[model samples]
Target: MAASGISFRVAQAVGVGGALWLSGNIAALSLISIPALVRSQTEDSVPTSILSRQWKYTFEAGKSQNPPIAVATATSFCYLAWSVRAGTQLGRLVPRNSIALYCIAAILTIGIVPFTIIAMTPTNSRLIAIAEQKRDAGGSVKPNDEPVEVLMKKWMFLNGIRSFLPLLAGATALVAVLG
Candidate 1:
């Protein structure tokens, strides 16, 4: 019983930490990176060239960071899942809100990957294609196929939503711990 309690506490800590980490990363991307890109687009540098360069760097950074984020999120989800199962088995020993918190955290943490796939992947692909085209053409391409600014705005909006999920999850989980 004590062991189970310890496990629950550890899981809650790790899960909250992971959720916060994800939230912070998304917030940074939305607040810092996207805004910087938008500002860069307005500069004297050709918009396509600035976008292409930024996008390439962003893609590379994402590729490098993705694995660790995935691992941390997966770990958090697994622990939260275990907590849910244990809470169910323990019945009255665990607060109902605690179980709900674990479930919410698990769902939100796990959901991010699929959300990215469904919500963000298409826009990302389109942006990457445009960036690549611009780069290949030696920054001469106009990105004439689509409105780059509109796409960037849309991406930023979606990213704000993405950032919110983990933030909510982390906050809920923290409340569960304190309450």
Candidate 2:
């Protein structure tokens, strides 16, 4: 079935919007939020439990929200690719390579899931474990400051890398559309 003009436009918008939204949020989390939290911890001598709890909350919130957006964005990109390939515009001048670009965008967007699971799960698991341990101990155990900071630093670095996937996806899709 051919995509109506309006349908194609909407799907493009969604794909573009969702990819950017995912990228921006992850960027903010990695660049702004987590850094600020860590800085606060260092400046204020915040307790382990409190610090871990804050990080935990932030991590949990993102975990809940980001995956779905990635999936949705990928779906939209795939649809756009199919629409273009299926000849949505009879006389429109979509390049032959646009389909490949759209497929690349969709792959990049959706690939964040397994990327996170495979690359980030160990760090995430350790951080969560620290938070849980501190919480379970009634927020009394301080543990080693170095370990917590080390983990946080590692997580921030990994997260920063992860943010780029969606960014690349958005750029790829936008370029394909504009061409």
In angstroms, the error of model 2 at 17 is 1.3
TM-score each candidate: 0.81, 0.91
State, as a TM-score between 0 and 1, how close model 2 is to the true structure: 0.91
For candidate 2, give the lDDT. 0.86
- Quickly count the clashes in candidate 2: 0
lDDT of 2 by residue, 10-36 (tens): 888999999999999998988998888
lDDT of 2 at 17: 93
Model 1 lowest lDDT segment of ten: 84-93
Count of clashes in candidate 1: 0
**Candidate models: Cα lDDT each:** 0.71, 0.86
Name every residue pair that clashes in candidate 1: none
Q: Which candidate is the best by lDDT?
A: 2
